[model samples]
Target: MIDQELTKIKSSTVLVTGGAGFIGSNLCENLLNNNISVVCLDNFSTGKLKNIQPFLNNSKFTLIEGDIRNLEDCHKACENVDYVLHEAALGSVPRSINDPITTNDVNVSGFLNMLVAARDAKVKRFVYAASSSTYGDHEALPKVEDVIGKPLSPYAITKYVNELYADIFQKTYGLDTIGLRYFNVFGKRQDPDGAYAAVIPLFVKQFLNHESPIINGDGSYSRDFTYIDNVIQMNILAITTTNEAALNTVYNVAYGDRTTLLELATLLKKHLVSLDESIANIEIKHRENRAGDIPHSLASIGKAKKLLKYNPQFNISDGIKEAVNWYSKNL
Candidate 1:
């Protein structure tokens, strides 16, 4: 079904901003694999050159080394594009907290630039990478789309603002938009050597090196750790779904299951030890919880399933296994 939908748009071009980043690069690869034309725009601030190096030689792949903060760059990438997958942003809550101004400048101002570029280019759809952090202090067990609380961090505010702007763009300018609220996504190509690196990849790399993995706050914090493939499916569905009800709305792109930090470390160790038995002796440490960290995060993927026919193929365990294998070979 995904292939059939993509086949319909094979003749069309997709402009993926931040295409050198983890999720963006994966999207670019999947689109190119499907014989779809892809234009990748990246500034390499957080996105690495190695991530998209494989696609550099592909005839269907076009790389625009530029920043989205500049509207001209956005315009250049959107030229002749049929659809837009806006993945460019300064991710990480701690990074945003340290420098809210830069985060807002790139996430909010840059997002607006892409919206205008896509609108002016007359693209069929504008799908963007929203964040589950938008759930904020809502304290809901299963986060639904409509009910959201005050944003807990600067990153959350920027993501929620993206949704608001997308709604206004659709209502006022007649541009179709879809916002995908991604949960704790992790997989191959994800950077594990950074201060703002995600937990799964960070832990995987630590285990591989025989270093102790740290668990914050007694390891009770849980997340709906979705895999990259599931996120890719959500993006494809957002752009290709024929259902009118699915258009101009936000959907949670997650696995619909939660795993605590302790559980996650245990699982990673279990998977990694299979490759190297000595890793089993690596101890897990604990520390105080970080500020603005949510106690638990689990998404209600019912809207995505009902509207976009999203069927997530990998759960946390399966995703961890694949990610562990990749990190073992790559790291």
Candidate 2:
């Protein structure tokens, strides 16, 4: 069972891989908000320094430009780090489909490098960004940790591989580790212009510019879109948890609710319209579904609830509302 007040480690030193990306940057902010010392590492493959520019001068923070795929870089970043939050990866199924070699190099080889560095450096705990895509082709309504399906894409395979490697590390190397299989996470600082950008940010940007946002299918596919804050909470919990049962396992981190693409567009339009009424009439176009895209995804976070005392505070609508507000202010 999870303790209500998890054991708090002295945040004297912490390293976050991909700390300049959407979810990673949010985690960095929350840790800093708690007065924790943060060491951020990124190769700028997708992460931008501007995302974490506010923390540049903070005495508690240090930025290291490094690639996780390189063992030397990982070793340098892991030096004296108390906790390691691994979030570096080339995300998005379409992107992986377009370039499987790059995705494999970053998500697999890079992840392994980070794990080796954490182990060699004797870090307290390793917490990595897993994905709901690990649930893959399962037709299950609510995804659970124990049950899984065939991987549907290169991206999904890589995440599942992360969990597998983490488990192996625990058994073989006596390394403490935890994996959070995050659902579709979105919030402030999510880049809205990339070819592989997430749905919420991209749609918000398009709506802001009065451009038609394309829905991959007929707009009926659904997802359990989680918030970045919730993901941060899970990382904090995973790193802080002292429960032996929870230390070496993977948990679903999500809002436990599903929303369809059509419903998502509707909600985005409503939020954008409230901010700027001119966006109300923005159209959403539909096309053939993209390959490697899951039809529907919803996570069963019971394991997280029981093991990590995980509590998610945002659903899709609330998250969307917050994300829209951020984009409105930032973009």
Candidate 3:
């Protein structure tokens, strides 16, 4: 889609709200690679300076240190921006469970602030990161966008509220919007040191150091485990699509496959073994299941493929191998 679809945004300027973070930094880098001017707004709460440091010297890349929880910051970031890719949020089930107040402040209230700023700025499109957590207690395989269950956690509630606010923003204020429900996005630059670190990078880091990585449950739980590039494709398509029917809706951004926790850990170990033979001997351990944790998560990407031409290029094996390689060298 790069030489074709992404060409549409080549002349446009994009504002990545969390451009110092993992997924946001990747998006910012991709846009800058295409010679598209990018303005990055981040407070470095969960974002890191190292992530955006490489782009600091680029003339086309601009960094605005600001928080999404502040409306002035949102307004300033949206100014003269052609499109907004909102990726700023507090992400993690346990984090929200520990402090629902801060989660709602950033995810729900901050999301609304961005919506209003985007509307007033008259940006062409507002594309934000939604999550599969919205699938919640719904016991279904290959989660579809239209169907959803009650939120299983405070973080899930906040993300669901983002979708609702986006929908109302479009209907009430004529602001076009699209939500990409990201599933387990992991890749280079993803932090492995946080208490809320995602499973993939965290596991890869532990294996690199010959530390046993813990599985939250008895290893029966599963996830779609999407790659960062697939997510980048979905975000680009969300902004560039000319399909009138695609706007004001949500789409699942995933590789459309699932891997059990046991399978995922084994996959990580297998790939990291190449870096250090000792990594093979590292044991995989398990404990009680995490609260707000679902047994499985899978996404049906039919909506994205049909509407946005989103074709995921990485499967679990391919994604894990790439992630392991990057972390081995960078982590």
Candidate 4:
């Protein structure tokens, strides 16, 4: 999603939780590029130092080694901040299925702590990462903003709860908040080693190593794999949008294009091979479908288009090409 022209706001100090994660790190870099001050809070659980290593010397960026689960840590991070981008979360459906309690602790309790801390700090706005999984169990062809279904997993529940809590916080405490329901975000700095690593990075790394990438289920499951730049645009718009009509709402942040996993791997391999022809022989393995995974996820960004003036610049092919180039140089 893109916001054409944003009003220059009064806030300079910004806090980004989970700032070392893939999307968070990109957002931090983009903000720094715009000459904005940033306070990054992270626990290094799933996030890594390498993601934000390039910014260690930037005077505009500050890193706080803290966990959002602790209110004290959240409070510390919120101080002197005008906006809070809450990206900290224990993501991954299978990971949550394996350990729902930890997921709940981080995604639910941790989110609440951030909200409370931001409210207490009198932050100008609080924009947090919501997920397209909130549309869970709904088999709609293209997910709209208003309609949603029951959360299918602990991760989904946690994200949906963020929206709920944001709404109540807005009503009860008068905190301005916005939620961006991200749909299958993937791009640069995305970790490829974790057990719950996203498909693109995992497949990219696997193919790079000349290893067979695994595809779950039949070759038909598709997703709206959004680019990191689009997500950065959404965050910038959400934080800067002063339109009363745009406040206190969740917008689907995606490219509105879907690609099946099988197709994705083939495309990735094509790109990787173009870079390093030796990897062209990399094969793909199919396995049983994962539990708690939606068969297809497609988002209708009409709401964002109409309300936030959102316009996505890259479709899946364009995004994948950029992502593959990043991985080629970095991973």
Candidate 5:
């Protein structure tokens, strides 16, 4: 279905910000596979060159080595682009807590610059990477788009602010926009070597190295862990959907389920042990819970299903198996 939609816009060009990062790089690869031209904008920062190396030589792929924090860079990348997938931003709640100024500068200021450039360029639509962090302290069992809570961290504030700015852009400037609130997305090419590394990749790397992965709490905390393919689908749907009611709204991009941290660790061990039986000996450790971390997260993907026809193909177990296989071969 998505392939058919892409065929209709194969002649179009897309500008993907932070296109060297995990999610952004995947988006570029999928778009290029569909024969769509892509302009990738990245300053490296947290994004790695290796992620985009495969696409660098493709004729349809163009790399714009620049920062989104600069309006000129944003404008340069937006030039003649038919659509914009704004994935550039400083991620991680702890990183934001440590340096709120930089987080605000890139996530907030940089986002604004992209909006202005997209509006000025008169792009068809602007689909961006919003975050489940926007749900913040809501305490809802299954998070909905309309009911949001106060942001618990600087990172959450930045993502929530994105939705606010996007709304204003649609109403005030007549630019079409869609915000996808991603929930703990993980998969191939995800970095597992950083201080702010996501849990799944981090644990997989640690187990492969015979190191203990320390859980922040009792391992009871859970999350709606989504796969990268599902996220890619949402972005494509947001860009392709001609439904007027779907525009200028936010949708939770998740698997519509939740998994406990302990369950996640156990599953990782089970899958990795299959690759190398010796990994079964690696112990899982526990530590105090990290500050500003949510206890549980689940998303109501009903809106995405009803509006954009989002049907997530990967569940947690299937996603973990694939992720473990990738780490074994690549890492």
Candidate 6:
């Protein structure tokens, strides 16, 4: 945060929707640390209560056990809030492929509900969690915000719809909004157990238990594995920016680099070996690639740097080390 804007942010009461999830809980922790009042809303469908349990006693923190799919719940959560950080959504491409209807209901319809609530509440800005999956089938090396391809999965479609709705909400309802298209975000508090668990944490969990992490392809597919701290900075910049040009737009939150699946597994094992020497001898395994997964994904963070002054501090290796350390004790 900029020194001048610190006071305004500290005094503001922000609503974090999905505040019990990995990314949302981290956002809550950072905001509370900065002396900001936070109102968290969640249905506990995907978000875990243990993620936000530590903050339950904080005087500045308020928890609303509600679902965004319900309009009344959205409206009620938006009450007395200065800004809305919309992080609630049904994530995972496979999950969406298995249940597209439920995904659309929560990701698209529920997003619309939150947009309506934030608009009516006259919140200063609505900063939301967009996804790199929105890049879709675009076969570009470095994905930019403007150059998007046709969505390959139901989850990608829902996230793209969010951008469309966010744009319309800005034009129609005069609600200032920012959409953060996050890449593969990983770090502390990220759950490693679930049917649709993210790759990094899931691999960490498997390696911790000396189990093989199945890589879909020949371990060649790569991603711009972003650290959670960088994502938090992007959101903070979105809500705290004073520049008019920075408003009503989307930004790619990533490390501006790429790491192949084999490379990622290697890095994880190297770091994890420090905790357990036997992990160094564990064999990394691979399998057939999943459908609709692109070969590689990298982001051009130039727009964020120029507009939001975003400077990501962690790279893939550093992020892996940090994440490995966390999983060593917490997982």
Residue 106: error of model 4 in Å? 0.4
lDDT against the true structure, each candidate: 0.93, 0.89, 0.92, 0.90, 0.94, 0.92
Off by over 4 Å in 6: 1-5
Considering TM-score, which of the candidate structures 3 and 6 is the better prediction for this target?
Answer: 3
What is the number of backbone collisions in each predicted candidate, taken in the order shown? 0, 0, 0, 0, 0, 2
Q: Against the hidden true structure, what lDDT does model 5 obtain? A: 0.94
lDDT of 3 by residue, 1-331 (tens): 6547778878889999999999999999999888889999999999999998889999999999999899999999999999999999989999999999999999999999999999999999999999999999999888999999999999999999999999999999999999989999999999999789999989988888779999988999999999898888888889899999999999999999999999999998888877899988889999999999988999999998998888999998898888888888898
Task: Return the number of clashes found in candidate 6.
Answer: 2
Number of colliding residue pairs in model 1: 0
| Stretches of candidate 1 exceeding 4 Å from the true structure | none
Give per-residue CA lDDT, model 2, range 51-89, as digits (tens). Answer: 999999999999999999999999999998989999998
> lDDT by residue for model 6 over 1-331, one digit each (tens)?
4334456677899999999999999999988888889999999998999999999999999999999999999999999899999999999999999999999999999999999999889999999999999989899779989999999999999999999999999999899999999999999988898899999999999988989888888988899999998988888888999999999999999999999999999999989888889888888888887766778899999999999999998999988888888888897
For model 2 the TM-score comes to 0.97
For all predictions, the C-alpha RMSD in Å is: 0.7, 1.9, 0.7, 1.5, 0.7, 1.1
Report the C-alpha lDDT of model 4 over 110-178, residue by residue, as the tens digit. Answer: 999999999999999999999999999999889998999988999999999999999999999999999
Give the CA lDDT, 0 to 100, for residue 19 in model 6. Answer: 98
TM-score of each: 0.99, 0.97, 0.99, 0.97, 0.99, 0.98
Model 3 misplaced regions, further than 4 Å: none
lDDT of 5 by residue, 1-331 (tens): 7788787678999999999999999999999989999999999999999999998889999999999899999999999999999999999999999999999999999999999999999999999999999888889789999998889899999999999999999999999999999999999999999889999999999998989999998999999999999999999999988899999999999999999999999999999988889999888899999978888999999999999999999999999988888888898
